[model samples]
Target: MIAKAYLWYGVYIILNVLTIAGSDPSGGAGIQADLKTFSALGVYGATAITALTAQNTQGVTALYPVADYIVAAQLDAVFRDLRIDAVKIGMLANVENVLAVSSVIERYKPAHVVLDTVICSSNGYLLLEPCALAALRDRLLPLASIITPNLHEASVLLGEPVAADEVQMIYQGDALRALGAQAVLIKGGHLLGNCSPDWLIEKSGHTRISSVRLKVIGTHGTGCTLSAAIAALRPQNRDWTNAVNNAKIYINQALLQSTRLSVGLGTGPLHHFHAWW
Candidate 1:
């Protein structure tokens, strides 16, 4: 009986991360990628799916958003049972879903929240509805511990064109931080250069984490993976900057290792289990 009790205690002590996002049937992005990332980083993953996508390496063909009440119920179920250590949010499809998630965040107040502003898919399919942008910016951004936005999403939030260069990215990062996120990570994957730079903006200052751009094609789900990694790492490190840096390093490695994986004809996904293999 004592041995069984210890075993249960050990199971209960494992770190748990909740990913609230859309579902990707291809297992390359959305909740799929987030779950892979959490597992790769040694954190147990739970999920509250907000949408479902018929997507693959090529592109997103269709999206079906889950009902708001169902989304809320999923979150409630997770929080009430599991002691969630961190949360990573992605791909909220509409205003109702956004508001539903926002209300749950306000209630649970999870230790770490990484919001990956997935406005659109890489293949130019709109993931978040146009009307939901206002609710996301107003209600969700403030509750997040960090907001990770790619250059294009940052532009959408800022109501401007894409940042011209690294300087403009920094400026945009600051502007995004002002919108209420405790920190902003402006990803530079779209930037044309030999290096990919991510600008981290906080109230204290900003940091530029630059890595040599890997010449690889299978780079899908990089943003989702990065944010999920940060969420998983933040609770252990307790420093947003370090968490971001570590996540970047992990992503770089994943990109490098995933080059040979020919999953699809178009853009492919990062090798989430690169470290393990």
Candidate 2:
């Protein structure tokens, strides 16, 4: 459990989790969103930044991928000290970083690994290179405890179109699971209507996790926020179902209260601090 108690003070047994992702100066997504989720959920958060992006509430302008050695060094530095309870991986900008991260993760073997299968930005900026897609599928999928992919991302992974309905979503999820992910969360937010459903498919069975889809004008960081919430809440919950449910509850409330935030022009970020203000 996170922050419940550690074998040592400020060390193993404590609630220390690392987020290996890119840096979003927009403060709506990437490492910024992940850290907010961790802090809001009362978990200790660390970082191993993969890239730096110039993005706002509107879209991405430029991206600079961090060196592979630096990425590995950051992971090593964090893992060498903290007793990481879980790891939330978001945008890996290239193939080299993917291999580097997977190699280190394969060695340390954190208890919980939540992989956010980020492919492209909502505004059409390619976050992960097309060349890196194979590395992600071959190396990262097998290691992730649960992989979170939106409908479009699922389609990209399977080389098919976006899942149109629940039946298709389930089929796609099962296929992705068969590819090696222990569990697959196919986010159905793109399906439209009042109920925004996400399917949690495991080897034993699958279950639906849905939230009221609010008629919001802007939602730039839903994927980053949701997946980060899962990583933050996983160690605290007894099972994966409870963890995902709690995360859903959090992101739903954040979306419902997003109007309170006047952040950007096109799509505003979720109200990550909804419970407080």
Candidate 3:
């Protein structure tokens, strides 16, 4: 038994990271942020672009959804070539894209699956169409190890805007669990308050996390970065608490550093590479 345990441990260490998220032409969010997080944590990152957006820190202007078959092909190519350790899904813009990625997840059953429900742009632009959301709820939610939804997405998923309050957030988690997600990480940024409180609710129990409200006005790809950090760290046997805590620390530092540099003309992206300096 000891020898077998040691072997398993060795396997885990060797396969530390893999992910599938959308591409951000702006390079502030989506796959760019995910890959940066993975690299920062010393993990290899992989991705399958779901859609392409023509926008930057300011807002998304135009989006072109990748064809369903192309999305499937990207996953197949990655699976055939690499030993994927974990997956982080974001920004499925259409029903076909959702179905395509969900089908792949069902087949491979990666060790860790983090879903950053990118339902809309940070500026309140609709990223996922209504039909796509329907597909996500019906096909994808049940498969995720954890679904990270901000207040707006959580409210939309439950058919109502969950009041942005502590008591209401807990209820929102329960409502999401009832919908089939094994775990719901309701991000508290949208809550109208001085401090943002993020909550993680699971079958066994719940936990609350908070950070002093950030002063930075531009936060473009923060969600994607958070989800990717969680996925990258999860394969190392870190619990969700540890995963989220570390992710928050990384994001906070990036945001603080990013506030100093002017990136885009509109809303700027988190300074993902700031750690180097």
Candidate 4:
């Protein structure tokens, strides 16, 4: 097994994270957003592109998936070189991609795997193929250390309506855990409220993380940013709760400052570099 904590010259080295996901030429979501989040959080980032998407803040025009074997090769090459501290997985376009990712996760067994269960885009674009949902639920969900699914994705996974309140949110979180995930974080950003809440359920316990609902136009990539923040912080924190707490704070700030950017015609993106710029 890889060392739980890395100490080089009596100082903890920078955490290395891999984003085994798709490419968004828009630079606001998917692999681009993941890499930006890693860099902003002082984590070294590596990537294994699963697909390439033609998308922008407004909408997605087209999507082209990479071959499953090629995706596997990229992951193998990274594992052979870097001590990948955490992995943030997004958009697995098809069943082949899902199975391929699950295979590598089983082989290398990264210490932390934050699965961003991105089923569709905010603009109503389908990111993961409908046929792949079963493969993801059966093959990939079980392998994740924590699965971060927004309310809609959670509903889709559970075949139920979206949670309307905290009680229902917790209920959904519990139900997701029953599906074999080690932990579940159900994001309630789409809920109608002045305060956005996220329910994080783990073996140790669960916590309700709430923040002021920052109304900003640059709301794209919030999912990628949040999950990436958790992945980037997990290696440095004492436990998952501590990591998630700090990640919420980071995302709150990102949302608070999102209006500083005006990149796209539609929703734009959260300010991933808010800490720096």
Candidate 5:
């Protein structure tokens, strides 16, 4: 009876969601976006900052990367005590950082791992070097349960131009699977079309979801938040497909609700708090 009481008491302790990503001073993307999305979805978030960028809604002006050892230390500290339920990985600014993060992930082997292949910014700036992308493809791709990459990043991964269309996205999805991701989500926001289709493909099959184009500008952190939401929901024991779909619904609702609200000077940030109020 005493053992049962201890078990019950401990089971209700803090729920931690881990995120590995960069930091945006503007609070629109990277670790900030992931944490906000996790909290909005009723989960606790912890982060290992990979890089620091000085940027606003307009664009990134400069970047400062954290030491690789420090990145590893953050993960070590978090996994030591926290009952981390899931993990979301974002921008790894360099090759060394990517390898370090991959090593930690393999060691801990968390319940769920979501990889956001943030190789570039929305404004056409390269976030990672060529070597870093190669490291991610070789080291991290196989470890991730699911990887979310926008068009530009996908093109870089596949070594071919990914057409911004259904056929192309599916083709690239298959290619990503070939690269060894357990699952892949190819975001179609870069496509110049009225309907934006996000493809979620896995080893079993493929699923495509379409949303009306959000007319709002400055939607900097939508991808980061969406991926984080998926990571946070994995603790509910839903499969990858369900998790991705639910995350899409959450992001679409958030975008629709905050279509008119402006948070930054340039390319506005998503209205993350719209539903909270």
Candidate 6:
């Protein structure tokens, strides 16, 4: 009876999420951003690091990918112990790491998976190799519940030019859906406009989410934050549109709050914990 009671208590404690990505020393992106966003949104976060990056707000200086076996071991440890409700995947530095992540996803099949196709840094540093990108497209896209890609990353994935306007963004979203993701969110923050709009394309239909683009320098981790927020929200909401909408609201507030503080020299990071303080 006591054991059953303990199990019930554990079930109600907190929704657990696992983030498989790289480590950013600056804490603005990668696993750091995912964990922060998950915690802020009331989810318990676990991590399995694919790489370690020496970087700051300005850019990534160097990257050291963890061995494939090590990445697999971390994922195994998390899955064997935690009842993970969601997953968020970020920068995979190489093909081996991508395969490692793919293997675990197939094995565990977490309920919600948000893949932030992090191929490059905000400052134009390459995070994933060409082979890694191919691997991700082939192995991981079909598994993700939703994929959040900025204008540039979407362009890369679709093998075309940048999405110059909303029409093109929608086209790209559909194209990405054709690639196998359950839903595609093409972020328009890089577009030239007063409002940043994201196109969410699902088989049911498509919708646009637009927010006033905050003219702020602290926008380093926006993609990671958005995707992580979606992953954290999915378990409760169980609706992709609501999950994405809530994430956008959270990110907008975080960006607004971050503008007041000075964190780094270059493109700064969002105040991920703004709600708490």
Tens digits of per-residue lDDT, candidate 2, 41-130, equal 778899999999999998999999999999999999999998798999999999999999999999999999999999989989999999
* Whole-model Cα lDDT of every candidate shown, in order: 0.90, 0.90, 0.81, 0.88, 0.83, 0.88
Q: Give the C-alpha lDDT of model 6.
A: 0.88
Provide C-alpha RMSD values for all models, in order: 4.1, 2.1, 3.7, 2.8, 4.2, 3.9
lDDT of 5 by residue, 1-277 (tens): 0001112355654457899999998888999888888777777889999999988888888888899999999999999988888899999989999999999999999988999998888776678877888899989999999999988789889899966688999999889988989999998887988988888888888888788887866477888888888888766645877777677777877777666675777877776666676
Model 6 lDDT per residue over 232-275, tens place: 88877748998888888889898999877687889899999887
Clash pairs detected, candidate 1: none
* Displacement of the residue 15 alpha carbon in candidate 1, Å: 1.2
Give the count of colliding residue pairs in each prediction. Answer: 0, 3, 0, 0, 2, 0
Clashing residue pairs for model 3 = none
What lDDT tens digits, residue by residue, belong to model 4 across residues 1-277?
A: 0113468889868779999888988898888988888888888899999999999888888989999999999999999999898999999899999999999999999999999999988888898999999999989999999999999999999899988988898999999999999999999888887988888998777788888888678888889888888898888887778888888888878888988998978888888888789
Cα displacement (angstroms), candidate 3, residue 153, comes to 0.1
Summarize candidate 1's per-residue lDDT along 1-277 as a digit string, tens digits.
Answer: 0001113454645578899999988888889998888888888899999998999999999999999999999999999999888899999999999999999999999988999999999889999999999999999999999999999999999899999899999999999889899999999988998988889999989888899989988789988889888988887774888888888888888899898687988899999888777
Candidate 3 lDDT tens digits, 1-277: 0001114544534444555666778788888888887777667777788888887878888888889999999998888788787789989899998999999989888877898888888777788989778889878998998999988888888798665598898898888888888788899887776888999998989999899889885577889888888887676654878778777888888888887777788878887767776
By TM-score, the better pick of 2 and 5 is: 2
- Whole-structure CA lDDT of model 5: 0.83
Which residue runs of candidate 1 sit more than 4 Å off their true CA positions? Answer: 1-12
Compute the lDDT of residue 66 as modeled in candidate 3: 89
